[model samples]
Target: MRETLLLLSGFVLLSSSTNLDVLLHQSVPYSPQSASTEQAWIASLESTHTETKAQTTSTVEGERVHGSMTREMKRQYEIAAYRRTKAQARSTPTATPSPRVATLNPIFDKQDIEPEHRVIADQAFRIIPGHCQAFLKNFYVRYDNPQHRGLGGKSTIILTGSVPDEEFRALFFHELGHLTDLGCFQGTAVAGSTPYMDKDEQIWKDDPSVSFYQISWMNSQAHNRGTTEEDFVSGYASWDMFEDFAESFVYYVLHREVFARRAAENDALAAKYQWFQEHLPDLPKVAKSNTRWDGAIPWDITKLSYDWKPPTELVARR
Candidate 1:
């Protein structure tokens, strides 16, 4: 009887780790919105390995501020600015209660982690290594319509545990880049410099059309250009400002010396790098040694999942 049970367990694990494509085809159908997000995520992933194709069909959602500026994106930016104000508020004794620690459900027991790898996870926005694809099975999503039920607030950093240190570092910053877009935190830092942006002026106050991303030279290959023409830190930065920030943030955080040297050559890149130094003043200079991203995660493109689904159901019943 014990042998039978052990066999059953092994089969379950094998199916999950190896049969993802089969599972996706048999699983819940993808909502258009969720599909779009999945496509964007996949594109971003592909960009790490190859030049990503332009996503002309992908639409940016928000109230139109001007040509491409949207109020929705501006609101996301406002949230980050608000977080700064809230951080300041917390400095006072009478400030509101601190936010609850971020919740995570990892397949590996935290009690089993070595001290060093655990530290790396915390610094990288509480990243938890697990089967990211299977994790999605727990949620329901409708991506195309905001009126349709879906998750809210949080974004995901999808990676398998076995990723190498360099790639893991890249993925960590990439997700943080998405978080920066939500205005959850300041997007820049310097070792000991003054705060990067105009504290008095809100970022959302400016016309979005005039932002640094509007520069004509920025494109899918922006990262490949010489420092003079490249406003982004890597090729992935060309995806969007959100991606640009994430790619740049990783470079700024992991390769501070390199970032500083390059910043000297480009005014726009310099300003972006300076934000991390000034705003996140206390961030450590480098990831701890012995950091291991060894957890394995299965991939499925069609699954409907999100980190934070709104409580209200947004879909209409037939």
Candidate 2:
């Protein structure tokens, strides 16, 4: 048996054997300048104005109102105006901050990752929809864990070791699948073994993924309930619903037409394809590929072609 690592708060780990991903946690609260501080500043400016006005009245009473003002009074008036200007600037609302873009931060031991590999990884990242990509923070590429191909967390992805360019792309997409499942459709947390709510703010049980899960699994543990090998995209997917979603996600991206042909033969696959079409319609499609659905499903879908619609084409689609 593979060694099981414990799940950490705000992060999830994905191993070759199982997928244990989590929802993106809430961001740190941004505390603007306190209201009381603004009020205090305003009050101080008012006090200064009152004093300046009173001095001006007393000093100018027996002389010309503007020309007889003392140097100190002029300086005070200028300071008061400056303070008023600052207060107004502070109170003015700023434009909302733009969302953070996902970045690939390689923690490799030698930093010898090939330029072509980086391009492949970038292409895979762009393949994900823009909205879904917004939820991601960092894609860490590390060489420490050679055994695990990829791992995913709330708003992060970890691609381990190195493989062929196509395999690297696929592995990244597989982990991205986990990120999309957890982050993109993240909902409220509830009390139970199924802790997350779906996109509709209901329990995780009602999630659209659950609908796909129901096609093969009676529950997470009981797999012998009516579903057959043909029903799943790959043997790994049959392991559990999380893997099912992730594996199917890769298939939908790398082999959409092949998957569509297979889906025609199997109603279960057709439904899964439909699920992707309906729920994740914005994902980029493969522009060119020679992969066919006639053979047995490959255990690793990432080992396939790397061709996909470029970011420019994807933008046009939107």
Report, for every candidate in turn, its global Cα lDDT versus the true structure: 0.36, 0.59
| lDDT tens per residue, model 1, 49-132 | 553233212223333233333557556656766786798888967856434333333421144333333334443443222222
Name the weakest run of 10 consecutive residues (lDDT summed) in model 1.
Answer: 1-10
TM-scores of all models? 0.36, 0.59
After TM-score superposition, the amount by which residue 201's alpha carbon in candidate 2 deviates from its true location, in angstroms, is 16
**Candidate 2, residue 278: how far the Cα is off, in Å:** 0.1
> Highest TM-score: which candidate?
2
Which stretches of model 2 miss by more than 4 angstroms?
1-115, 189-203, 306-318
* Candidate 2, 78-166: lDDT as tens digits: 67667877989999998865333334433211134455665566656666667877877655454443444666544765565456666
Clashes per model (N, Cα, C within 3 A)? 19, 0
TM-score of 1: 0.36
Residue 134 in candidate 2, Cα distance off native in Å: 2.8
